[model samples]
Target chain A: MAEVKLTNVVKRYGSVEVVHGIDLEIAHNEFVVLVGPSGCGKSTTLRMIAGLEEISDGEIKIGETVVNNLPPRKRNISMVFQNYALYPHMTVSENLGFSLKIAGKSGAEISAAVANAAEILGLGDLLERTPAELSGGQRQRVAMGRAIVRHPDVFLFDEPLSNLDAKLRTQMRVEIKKLHQKIKTTIVYVTHDQVEAMTLADRIVIMKDGHIVQVGTPLDVFERPVDTFVAAFIGSPPMNLINGHIEADHVVFSDGNRLPVPPDFTGKLADGRQVVFGFRADVLMPKGHTLAESGVVTDLDLKIDFAEPLGSESILLSTLGGKEIQARMHNPRPVNEGEVLTCELHLEKCHIFDASSTKNLRE
Target chain B: MSKFSRAIRDHAVPLALIAPSILVILVVVLLPLMFSFYTSFTNYRLIRPDTLWDWIGLRNYQRLLADWDFWVAFGRTILFLTVALNLELLFGLGLALLVNKITWGQRTLRTIMMFPMMFSPILVGFQFKYVFNDTIGLVNNALQSLGLTEFAIPFLVDRWLAFFSISFAEIWMSTSIFAILILAGLFAMPKDPIEAARVDGCSNWQVFRHITLPFLMPFIFIAMTIRSLDVARAYDVVDVMTGGGPAQRTELLWTLIARTAYDDARMGRANAMAYASILLSIFFTWYFFRKLMDARKHLGAF
Candidate 1:
């Protein structure tokens, strides 16, 4: 295992610069996920680290040596592509042992490695099957097996689970997490799915528009997103942002609705400063019910536009201070649309962003 | 009113739809094939119409069996097919690999590469005939100007040189058929396998040999199957360039058949030779098709 470090890495296609100078450091045996929307340069950054793409400017070190000029093979890294990228003509065992074969290892050593990977991936029965004969989930496992057999310094996965169905994707995601635990190698995985990053990454790197927006542990980023983009991007049902301004110890909405500032940020804001009030759905549950967070709470009445009951929890779509918002209800009875419900907001759990720059105000 | 007539009447629309095609086939294909097969057993000559009724059973086949010249031509034709097809494949593969690398002006280069394939084989034959002319040809002039030799090289006269010259023209005209098809194969090739091979620690050549070449085999066999049937069409070029002369050095099957049928007016012998050459075509087509299927199976496409 080796530490993968990128200092000011940049990627440009002709006159168009797609990946701006970005710095990242993935420690030895750490699982770092690069998550972003399409065209956000997460995949490009991963490819550059893999040496499949050239860095326009920067230094990438896979241990003690800079690998900017190294070819992908010489870089001693393995990649699992979104399509699984298995050799269609070869059987699963051959695909798993291809790197070892290329490295000129003895047949016995290659087979041993193949057998180990197959056993780990539950691919013993699939050794003789070609890629075309395998299902999508099986092919994904073979791809992972192929990567592991090489024992490269780092593993790069580019949306490897995106092609599978939801159940299979979830299963493979858990399998990948288990694989990482077993192998204990540095991994730089790129995906647009925040849930994958949240569940699997030791450190999650969130990017947008070619820039690294934030890099933190999943809980760190979830608890304290550095900016509005990270806040909205890293959660499902998304964080709600209400446009408002700080005025006299209270946030004033454009439609004249006002709420006192949470006690945590009592003195952090100046009067008349425009800001975005952000809160997560789970925090604003029905009164008297809170998840893990216990803090100073505020109560507000919201007219429900719709309610989605998910058995243990329900997502209530409503208007807060004249802006669309989603609140979570814990073990609550189903409520009718347009019903007025009082929900509690864990004041300390909410986020506030500067309106002009969109950075977290309390960061 | 009968059962058969009633059945036919019941399928009248479908029968009517197919009748024209069947009639056309009988008139244009089946009749000529039957007439040719019949002539192969008779002493039919184009000049002597009365020989049409003469039944000389197996006489032409018996004479051809012992004819040393016929055997030599047959052997030469096989040699020509093998050498020309292999050379074309090599050059075509090289050209495709080179063209696939060019990012700029690739469209223009591909269009230019197809220029030879666009020219008629007869036109290409005439073109090369002048280019290889013993004295005034471009090749001889260039050699003379460079002081390589005092006498012009007999490119179309010496037995081996004439064989080389004719095969050159054939390869030049049809190599792009392989290139175009192989390029399409290259275009359709997924980038993931090549990338996977590279990540698997393969060098450039290894990646090409193990991944790219295997991926291209099915396309190569497809091109071979098509060109095998059409390689006979090179008769026009060979006829114009060497005319099966200089001791029959470049005598392909079709050239020999054309000479026997038209030049010697021995239609019966030519038809017999034509029937024998048809077997060669069928064999090549069958061989290439089997190879195509094998390649597809190896790629797990089947």
Candidate 2:
């Protein structure tokens, strides 16, 4: 295993730069996931590290050696593509042992390594079947097994679970996490799925338009997103931003309703300056005489547009003064469409962003 | 009665549209095939058309069995087919591999390679005939001028050289057919499996041997089967170059059959020989098709 580092790496295709200068450090045995939307250059970055793509500028270091000029075969890195590119003609055993055989290992050694990988992946019974006969999930396992048999210095996954069904994706996600735990190899995974990034990454690098927006642990990016994009991207049932202005030391909405600002925002804001108040749906609750009564509460009278019952909690899609907002409520409350509902926003948990820059005010 | 009439009424227009094609096939293809089969059983001659009424009762078959000239032509045809088809396949596959590597000027080179294929087989035969002439030819003159040979080489007169000369002309005229077809196969191959093999840590040669070659097998056999059928009926080049002369050293089955049917006016015996050669074509086509299906099944497309 080895730590991989990229120092101001840039990728350009004929004068148009696709991957702007990126700097990252991945320690040995760390599971770092580059997560973003499509065309975000996450895959390019992973391919550069795997030596599949050339770095147009800057240097990439694997362990202590610069690998910018090294080919993929000499990089000691194994990649599992999203399509699970198993050789269609070879049986699972041959597929697993291909790298070892190419490296000039003896037949006995190759078979021993293949057998060990098969046992770990529960692929012993499938060793004789070609990839054409295997299902998608089994093919994925064979692809992983091929990588495992090599015992390469690094494992790279480029959206490896993107092709599976949702339930299988979740199952494989857990399996991959468990496998990483067992092997503890340095892994650089790329995906557009935020949930996978949250669950699988030791540290998540959020990117947009080929630039790294933020790099932090999942919860760090979740609870303390540095900018609006990270704040909106990191969570499902995403954080809501409401347009408002500071008036009389309180945030006043466009509809002229006023709410108390958190104590930390008082000195940072100028009077009559526009701001966006950010809050996650789960942090808000129905007005009641419990914690809502004790904590600093900002009231909102919202008209319900729709409600999605998610078994454990219901997501309420409602409008406050013509602005759409989604709130998660825990109680099994019966609410009708177009009915006015009074909810409490926990002021202490609310985040404030400057209207122009969209950066978190607390940061 | 009314329902039956209505069903017939619905089918009448479509069947009417196909009537000309059916009539053409029956008049053109089926009539000739039936006439030839009938002639195979009779003692028919082109000059004496009245002899078509005679029932030969396997006289032509008996004669062919004992005829050393006919059997020699038959054996020579088989040998020519085998050698020419195999050589064409080798050269064609080499050409396809080379053309596949060329990224620039590929279209121009492809057009230039097809120039030979566009020429008539008779033209190619005449071109090579003059080039390999024993005297007053380009090859003999060049060799004499270079002082490589003191005597004019008997390219069209000697047995082995004559055979190779005819086969070479045949291969030159048809090898591009194999190359074009195999190149199409190469272009249509999926890039995913090759990339997968590379990521599996396979060297370039290993990837080609294990992945690329197996996928191209059906195409190779397809080209072989087509060229076999084509080369077995080799006549135009042989007729022009040597005229199956110089002691009939380069005579193939079709040349001998044409000589009998048209030149000697023995249509009945020629038809019998043709029916025999049809077996060779059938065997090759059937074998290649079966192998093609197996390859498709292996590729998981079946």
Candidate 3:
């Protein structure tokens, strides 16, 4: 296992900089996932670490060596591509043994390593099958097995589960997590799916527009997002953000709707500061349908436009200050359209952000 | 009967549409093929029209089977086909690999690469004829200027040199066909495998041998199958460059057959030899096609 350190890594395509001098350090044996939207430089960052793409400036270190100029093979890292990238002509055993063969390992060593990897992935029965004959999940397993056989310093995954169906993707996510645990190697995974990042990451690095926005543990980033983007991106139904301005202990919306400042930011903000009032759907619950009764709660009347029942709980679409907001209804009951209900806005769980900067003013 | 009529009625429009092509093939191809088969059994000569009806079954075949000159021409043709096809494949694969790496003006380069293939075989033959012409050719002139040769070397007249010159011309004209097909395969190949191979600790050469070449095998074989057919029926280039001459040094089956039919007025023997040479073409096509299928299977099912 090796700690990967990217010190001010910048990737440029001509004068247009794609990954703009982002720095990150991943600890040894850490399952660090780079999560972001498309064109967010997460994959680009992963590729740079893999040495598939050159870092335009700055340095990337696997262990202690500056691997910026080293080719991919010399970097002593393996990558699992999005489409599995198994050699189509080769059987599963051959695909697994290929790296060892290229390394000029003895035939007996190669077969032993291949067999060990196949056993790890439970691909023993599929040793003779080509990639075309295997199912999507099996191909993914072979791709992982190929990486495992090499025993690289770090494993780079570029959205490895993106091609599989949702069920298979989840199954493979667990498999990858188990693989990481069993092998105990540093992993730098890139995926657009925040759920995958949240589920699999020991630490999640959220990127946007080639810049890293936030880097924290799964629960850390989930509970304490740095900005409106992170706040919206990390959660399932997203945090509810409504535009407002502060006016002497109250947040006032355009429609003259008012709310007292959340308990955390009671006296920190000055008067007449334009702000964004944010809370997750979990924090805004129907009065009796709340999960916890310990937080500082405020009961407010709101009209439920519709309800989306998801078995045990339902998300009730409602309006707050002319902006559509969602509130949770735990142990949900069917609600009539346009029915007004009292919702408990948990002030302790809420956040206030500067309107223009979109930065969370939590500190 | 009703099912048969229904099937005919169901396919009536397509059958009608293709009827013209079938009729044309029947008249132009099948009829001539039948006539040639009939002519091969007779002692026919162009000079004696009445001799067309003189059936001499097995005589022409018997004479040809025993003819040392004919057998020599047959052997030369086989060797020419094998050498030309193999050389074309090698050159084509090399050219394709080189051109596949060119990213700047690749389309322009591909177009330029195909310039030789654009020229008709006869034009290519004539072009190479002057290029390799013994005394005043570009090859001899270049060699003389470079001090590679003491005097003018007879490229088209010397036995080995003549074979090399003819084979070189044919390869030049058709190697791009292989290159283009192989290039198309390169374009369609997924880049992920190569990247994976590199990340899997493969050198540039190893990546090419273990990944790129295997991926390009099916395309190479397809090019082989096509070029083998075009090369096995070799006539125009050798005829134009040396006329199978310098004492029958470069005589191929086609050249010998043409000379037999026209110069010696032996239509029956020529037709018999033509039919026999067709077996060679069929064999080459079949062999290359089998190789193509095998390569495709190696790459996994379609």
Please state the Cα-based DockQ of model 3 relative to the true two-chain complex: 0.71
- The Cα error of candidate 2 at residue B218, in Å, is 2.4
Candidate 1 wrong stretches, greater than 4 Å: A288-293, B1-3, B298-302
Poorly placed runs, candidate 2 (over 4 Å): A244-249, A271-275, A289-297, A320-322, B1-26, B62-67, B101-109, B134-154
Alpha carbon lDDT of each predicted model: 0.90, 0.87, 0.91
Candidate 1 vs. true structure, TM-score: 0.97
Pairs that clash in candidate 2: none
Clashing pairs in 1: none
Worst 10 residues of 3 chain B by lDDT: B293-302
Q: After superposition, how far is residue B197 of candidate 1 from its true place, in Å?
A: 1.0
Predicted complex 2: CAPRI docking category: acceptable
Query: For all the predictions, what are the DockQ values?
Result: 0.64, 0.44, 0.71
Model 1, span B1-302: residue lDDT tens:
69999999999999999999999999999999999999999888999989988888898888888978878887887787888789888999999999999999999999999999788888999999999999889999999999999999999999999988988888989899889989998998999989989888999999999898988999999999888888754589988998988678778788888989999999999998888778888998999999888778746642
Per-model TM-score on C-alpha atoms:
0.97, 0.89, 0.96
Candidate 3 CA-lDDT value: 0.91
Per-residue lDDT, model 3, residue B165, is 95
Ranking under DockQ, best-scoring first? 3, 1, 2
Sorted by TM-score (best first), the order is 1, 3, 2
